[model samples]
Target: MIRSIIHDEMFLSVPSEKAGKEHLQTVQDLRDTLHSVRERCAGMAANMIGVNKNIIAVTMPFGEMVMINPVIIRKAEPYETEEGCLSLKGQRKTTRYRKITVRWQNENMEVMKADFSGFTAQVIQHEIDHCAGIVI
Candidate 1:
């Protein structure tokens, strides 16, 4: 049997006391969305782009990372270079960032921390922005 490649899990909205219907689904949607996010994050890993406000956001299996309420822990001096993303299609441009530390909770309610440098750092920032509902 062919395995499913769809993800529909949605993260919880901020301030649990005031969560809306989208944040309180029946569960299946949540699982699917989360799965899709991971897959997109992983598959798009090779194609992630550097930080560029002018550049379009990267595309993913579930549309986009669409992360909600994300925050950056630390950042290092930035360097400049061209960048690309799977979502950006066949394009590249100069981006900046030296090294950065990131922390964020996933749809599964787990905290993840990682150190990123060069291209990876930019990708993480891009993805985190996606998680926080940033399109660019």
Candidate 2:
């Protein structure tokens, strides 16, 4: 289903962890939401669709991927960039890392980690901010 993108107070509020079986649904929802907006969006967070959970779906160079409870473990030097959100129009000036290592869970609830750089790193940072209830 194509969930509505939330831009209210809740969207700006920090999201909670989605653990156990409930996360399966949230993951699917995030995937669905990401698919609905992938054409114009690089990624999306659960809060953007009014689901206050640490879930995000992103479009990588290879393909689309889902992250559950994603956390940035390492980061390189900071760089300023312009980023926009699906829940909000217009771009905002935000600072992001040039390279990063993130740890997250997949749809099967398996833990995984990977390295990202350049634009991909910036996109991951932006999605992480949304998981923390930040717009920019």
Lowest-sum lDDT 10-residue window in model 2: 10-19
Write candidate 2's Cα lDDT for 30-127 as tens digits.
77878877789899888887777888888976767888889999999998888877777788998889989999988888899999998778888988
> Looking at candidate 1, what is the lDDT of residue 125?
66
Residues 1-136, candidate 1: write the lDDT tens digits: 1123222222211111211224423123323433455543332211122111111122344543422233568887866655433344444554456788766444463566666676556765655544443333
Model 2 vs. true fold: TM:
0.91
**For each candidate, C-alpha RMSD in Å?**
10.2, 1.5
Estimated TM-score for each candidate? 0.43, 0.91
Clashing pairs in 2: none
Please estimate how well model 1 matches the true structure, expressed as its whole-model Cα lDDT: 0.40
